[model samples]
Target chain A: MFQGRIIDTKLRKLSIQDAEKFIASSDFGASIFFSGTVRNQNDNKSVIGITYDTHDALVIQSFEEIYNEANEKLEIKNKAVFIDHAKGYLNLGEISIIIAVATKHREEAYKLSRYIIEEIKKRSPIWKKEHYQNSESNWLKGNPLVNEKN
Target chain B: MKVKIELFGATRDFSDQNILELSLNNDSTIEDARIEIIKYLKKNFDGNKDFVRIVNTSAFSSENNNIVSDNYKIKNNEKIAIIPPIGGG
Candidate 1:
């Protein structure tokens, strides 16, 4: 069985104790967890805050698709996935996204965890608006690495 | 006839406006509307061949994958959504 969840919440304060408790309920032998936090710097500019805006319907649907695809392609036993990203204003050091996966073996767990993060970064329809110290804000488009237009 | 075009993602940023009101002939197809949109947006946007997807009602049509013909009638006040691919961490 593979469990997956996508939520919008303030996860910066996500505690390790709570994560341990969630992992404790599972019978898997190995667990992998990943957290994405708001970085204070971007392209040498000091980012004061970020606002994430998303097409709610499409984002949720795309996330479900990614989750399903990861489960089908990864060789894992009794996997569980949890993702939470904030929707409104997020300050520096706030947790942007959290992913945790569990499996019976370490290899599969590690591989699947990395794969999910990559796919989400590439495919998800979420967009971010970054605000700098000078009170300037711009809506950034897509993955900076893959989607940058030449 | 008039049609409402709703923009999403980077497409909205390119347009600098979220909604566009397009006046078209009664027999105009969706493709015609798109061409006019492309021409209007070309003044502000650099890329002419930028790929975009259209959502009419609930159906999704990609500019590369789907074909819109003259038989396609866009009703007045109908809303069409334009979506561009979005990527972020």
Candidate 2:
């Protein structure tokens, strides 16, 4: 059985220690974690905050697709994946997204972690609005990079 | 009649929230609904011309078109989602 959780909350409440402990007791030999933080600068402009928006239904569907793809591509005894994103107002240094993957070996853990993030960025409908310190805000569009594989 | 208007992406930012409910007359069209939204938002945020864009239930729609046809009437509790162009990293 695969476990998935999606939440919108204050980033300060996220317990990294609890996540690490849970993965450790799951009998997994290796674990990988990815955290995306609010950057202070973008395009040489000082960022004040970010507002992330999403078509919630489409986002949830895309997440499920990514989860299934990760399961198919990785070979492991057991796996646990958690993705939490913050909506509304987020300040600098706050964790906007946290992804944790547990596997039986280091190589699979690393590979799966990278793959999941890339796919999420490529396929998800979530969008971000970056607010600069200069009283200007701009929306960061979806991936402009084309997939080399295709 | 009451209709549920769902705002997504940039539209949500413009409205400062995700969902809005509006009461319209029996003859209201999608264009009318949009106009009501535009009027409501202009009271809060300036720059009306640049913010005009639309997304239908399934895909993106133009500013001049009606989201629902005359034959298809929107009743109480019916939902329509409006999506602005998506921007993400």
Most DockQ-accurate candidate: 1
**DockQ for candidate 2, C-alpha atoms:** 0.19
Clashing residue pairs for model 2: A140-B87, A140-B88, A141-B87, A141-B88, A142-B88
Tell me the tens digit of each residue's lDDT in model 2 across B1-89.
87777775656666555677788887566556666676766776664554543322123222222333323455556677654544433
The sequence of per-residue lDDT tens digits that candidate 2 reaches over residues A1-150 is 243344455444445664665566456778888888888988898999888776556656666677787656665436766665556668888777777878877888888778877777765666788899889897764442221110
- The total number of steric clashes, by the backbone 3 Å criterion, in model 1 comes to 1
Which stretches of model 2 miss by more than 4 angstroms? A1-3, A10-12, A55-58, A74-77, A143-150, B1-3, B13-76, B83-89
Cα lDDT of model 1 by residue, B1-89, tens digit: 88877665555554555777888888676667766676665654543444322222112222332322434667776666544455555
TM-score per model (chain B):
0.61, 0.63
Error of model 1, residue B42, in angstroms: 6.0
lDDT of 1 by residue, A1-150 (tens): 333333455544444444555565446888877888789998888999887765555556666677677656874436666655556677898776777777778888899879888887765666678899999987664542122222
Q: After aligning candidate 2 to the native by TM-score, how far in Å is the CA of A73 from where it should be?
A: 3.8
Each prediction's DockQ against the real complex: 0.28, 0.19
Q: What TM-score would you report for chain A in candidate 2?
A: 0.82
